[model samples]
Target chain A: MSQDSQPRKNSRFHLTVFALIAMLTAVLSVGTPAPAQAEDGTFKLGLVTFLSGGAAGPFGVPARNAAELVIEAINKGTLPAPYNSIGIAGQAIEPIIIDEAGGGTKQVGEYRNLIQRKNVDAVIGYISSGDCMAIAPVVEELETLTVFFDCGTPRIFEDNKYKYLFRTGPTSTMDNVAAARYVLDINPDLKSVSGINQNYSFGKDSWADFKGSIQTLKPSVEFKTEQFPKIYAGQYGAEVSSLMLEKAEVIHSSFWGGDMEGLVLQGAARGLFDDFTGVFTCGETGMFRLADQIAEGTILGARGPFGVYAPKSPLNDWLRKNFMARYGTPPTYPAYKMAQALMGLKAAADKAAATAGKKPTQDEIIAAFTGLEFEGPGGTVKMALGNGHQAVQDMYYGQYSNKNGKPTMTNVKRYPADCVNPPDGVTSTEWIKNGLKQASCK
Target chain B: MLKTDNTSRNLCIAFVLLLLVGLILPNWLAFLTTIALAKAMVVVGLVMLMRAGLVSFGQGLYYCLGGYTVGIAGQHLGITDAVGILFVSAFIAGCLAALLGLLLCRYREIFFAMLTLAFSMILYGVLVKTSELGSTDGFNVAKVTLLGWQPSPGQLSLVVYSLACLVAFLTAFFMHRYYQSGMGFAGEAVRENEIRVEYLGVSPQRVVFIKYVLAAMLAAVGGSITAMIAGHVDPEMAYWTTSGEFVFVALLGGTGHVVAAFIGAFLFEVIRTIAFDLAPYTWQMILGTTLLLVIFFLPKGLWSLLKAKKVGGNNV
Candidate 1:
């Protein structure tokens, strides 16, 4: 075993060479903006996120609201700095919105259009992980400066090839890890657990992370059943039947959007939560959308960058008030995430504005975004200059409680950003350095 | 009347237009349009079965199975070629579908649809429980190996899908070929009155079962083609709604021709895009309105509308 280990350590030479190349390139492009074009002049901004479909009515609408508020605030000159002056050359920004529908190549096609045809200055927003992951290739290939606000998957950070893509939300791993910590902390006496996630990447990723973390934190937990239902499959009657049969001490569910509401409503009706200590990780985000359906005792985890009222950050508080005032209802975490991401990209804009030699180029703006840290409503969130390219962000966990006749998570716990570290072999920024090579026009 | 069954032959026209779009349009539109085209492939296949006296709400299961097969084979088996992935996925789903079809074909009408749906759910259940395939966590599919060819750019994926649409058309072409032939008439006779086909000494059960298996393999091909293009796959591809979408696209096209599947699927995706973009909250209204309009006016389906050329002085 020791001899095998010795050979493997040396075989990591390939990874080391790649890392060194990345480091050198990161050093060489120290001052050069990525595109070096004047995007400050009149230009289009593409907003790609889920705005309809099963998940849209719930989680996506909130994300849409955030983008709208950001655009409106930016256009009206009301969006506070570091985003106040986020425009190219001397032109005002025009936000063109596109809704990513279904998990097929449709979203990627729209994104390719957004960058190549529309000539959008930058891209922001993704509510669904499937869309986010699918678009990752497009954005990398196109070399567009894109910021992902809500679609959080560890895969995005684990791969170093995408230099232009940046996501501010917690990864799938982070959400799972946070929820596990939240559930185990509350029910430390728990020994047996089961998982029920939507049958897709988001569900499987979260479920795997939760189980892995649960084992890491507490070694004695026995896993019972892992049930995955088809996404947007209106009924969960049979999957629920299996979960009930498991009779585990805790039920860990990663279902979201309409599927989440459908399962929760159905599970509640079947009394699945009656005896089981439920860990409904994705419940908090869609609580407002689902309203009364989520049961009180269920633990709701947030892909949140700190909640509005919980453990105050000045930026977070101010943004909360602005969002509520602008949108007329308290914004959900997705809204905040989209808003924060655009605001962060505006940091790139500001950096471009600051060093234009009279005006900044797209390259300068892109350069400013890399390794740049900005104070926003979510406190000072920093982009990962590391190869995985994900910035430092935290997640919040709250227990669901009856607040003003609706289900909301309380007893929230805050974890540090570094708590959920990404796997090695990932670093800052992956983009399509060879955009013209791909012939996006086909 | 069945001359319209030459969908593959007719697809040549759309393929030409697609080439034009590929060269002239901005990539974003081309890319989105390509996806819409790819989706149209399955919608075409599903519409064929629906017209033949079956409506499956289990298309998503097969779709998901095809996707997962490609995903699992590529990730686990280290096969990355798009063509290889599609072959592996289609073969796996086709074999399983044939097995499942054997059991499901015994039932008639809703029973058949329900049984297929139940089987799809079983696959969905398996995908979720088995963490080795990442369960609900989707796996990232790298470049698709298409018969030793790789589609790297989103455009390449689009082009590959365009070819897949061709493949789907050819399958439908053959299905139409079968439909126009003696066996198709026999199947129709069975559809009209199964007791007569049974009385004729040719077992209706075997014919329908074989037809079911054949139709499933076609859908599996469509699904595999899509997974290769999407670069990721989830079990949701096999969900009930996924299956229902096939019925929706088929019916929307109204089985006027196999080509209607392409048109219906394309229109569904395009209308969906419009609906979501314009009213997002009420995009279903577009779907409802289109369904209402088509059912009311173009009762034969969308092909008739496209075929309705204004003849003024012949070619004025």
Candidate 2:
């Protein structure tokens, strides 16, 4: 080898790496330009959801799956109402997808790249409540329309009233309040209530909101011994031992994914559920992943604006089978919620194209989406412009029961969006200052 | 400057050109490069420790400690000045290390590593249980108080990047000086032969412990810088895995030279991005393979490999 030729080789390598980087940057820049090109059929709907990682995306994964199934079903002309033969205006809605399965600063940048550079018409994403709370402001500034599926952090919507943002799933306030009401419904005289939850905003807020509702609803039930465990981390043996020792009649937890599954398995192993009634705030996976170890008699609450296994409706069944067929799993509510976000965009586009007599503008889509409630497999769901771009939707509670050796929500009941959620006119900042609002679903 | 490998120094100049490419590279690259710089800070400190006969698995403890202190001090104590916070963080780690070093100074070899690890685990346990501090969820920092003027309103990215350059410059400056000092000589000697170092009238335990404290302080500065840039810090920063990452970066850079840390940092940032794009799900596999290859073939680190090629030798 000629040593004199080496500088040229290094230069060539560096040049190639530079050129490749240049090409990538050019591709990335023009790739997903928001509002740059409004060409019909060219518009991409970026549906970001967690397809991997921790139990962070249990609801979001299902929501994304359901969204995919709905898109598939709608593409096939198999959905109900204005959804049949649903081609948005004259242009068909196309999905450009990315997975935001993990949360952190890195993942947020990834979302920005998808929304800003991928040139998505909308973003329906995020399962982790913390990530959603962090990203809300950025998306608001960018105005890349996003419809969140199952990030239940109340702080997300309480602050900004972001124009381009909308939430479809229930809030943490709704989920916990509904859980408390459901428990009291079963036994009115239930006394001591203990909560063991993941120590993030969702878990802590679940206990706080549930306690607030319980204080107002079942005046006699004293909430005590609240346990906050780090989410998706460590064995819950010590936390569970403390709870078991408490002998509280009603135990509520917001642990989900592996943490939920692990705790339930351990509690069952330890006979922690021998006589006590237990409620899980997010036990809504339809037994796809967590069914094996979830102790019997424990009720799970869902942010179920899209009903979880609502009826034998052919479309729901088709969606279920379709998702199972495609993904080797039954459709969870998150999948449907994700589908709703997409369908909502396509529906808006179609409506705008009809009313404007042309392709939908950003304003037209915005107008169409405002107070625009559409009926789907799980009844009508609407998004009113709430504070910080939060969804005002129903949260449901159900007892997990075996249906043919599968976990399904039984005794489900709806707690409306405005119930326990901040008032319709309230802003996120004010809600934070006022703490959470308390209301009965009735 | 005198201790640095020339080829790596040129690669840095080349990276400066690559950074120019970033001007046109889009926000994604800028975002990623920022993270790499942040991680590199901690990695540099690890290299320093490794040179001194110390392999710290508790660097994360200092990182988390520095990060949380900056966040809390900025948000609560009104210490919004970014430079001041860094100083405060470094000072805090220095003090904590000095106190802990007194006890740790008498310990030898594996016991020192374990004791530092124990300190980190204690921090993790305490932080996890303390919900008001956001504990395991971590404190979401809104802004770094830059003196009385906070920089979040305008030029958030630029302000952070500027502070980053200053920190990098400072880290390189101080760490370079550290490696050239009599302490540096003792550290190398201590790593090579502790009994000999003991015979030379410097207790190996004391040298290693002092090195441990200094490394902890450096790691703390890095952590504070990252927390300010990212706007979040959690107990995860204190996890042993975080410590392990620094060690990996040191190994990747060959740990023999100060500039290798910078080279390792750049490669890590670039490769990690490439990995994320290519496999998104299985990036760890690529990371593992790269590490194995670097460890097995280029035992002197990437810089040493480049230097060997300059000799016109056949061996790679």
Best by lDDT: 2
DockQ for model 2? 0.19
What is the C-alpha lDDT profile of model 1 across A1-442, one tens digit per residue?
Answer: 2343443433343444475467435423432333534344555677766666676766677777777766666666665545555453335667777766655455665566567645677788677666676677767778888888877666665644667877766566667776777787788887899888876667776787788777767879999999877678879899889889989988998876667777888888988876686776666656666566666677776565544323466556666787778777777667767777777777667677777755566677777777777775667676753543466666677766776885555787776665554434432112111111211111
* lDDT on C-alpha atoms for all candidate structures: 0.66, 0.69
Q: Could you tell me the TM-score of candidate 1?
A: 0.77
Per-residue alpha-carbon lDDT of candidate 2 for residues B141-187, written as tens digits (9 for 90 to 100): 65765556655533565566656765675567666667777887898
Q: In angstroms, how far off is A201's CA in candidate 1?
A: 5.0
Shift of residue A188 alpha carbon in model 1, Å? 8.4
lDDT, candidate 1, at B201:
84
Q: Could you give candidate 2's per-residue lDDT for residues A301-417 as a string of tens digits?
A: 656655463445655555667777888876656666666566666677677777998777887887787777765444556665473234456666777666569666667776666
Deviation (Å) of B63 in candidate 2: 2.4
lDDT tens string, model 1, B10-119? Answer: 66676566666566654544445555555665665565555557667787776777777777677777787765666666677678777887777778788988887888
Model 2 - which docking category?
A: incorrect
Candidate 1 whole-model C-alpha lDDT, 0 to 1: 0.66
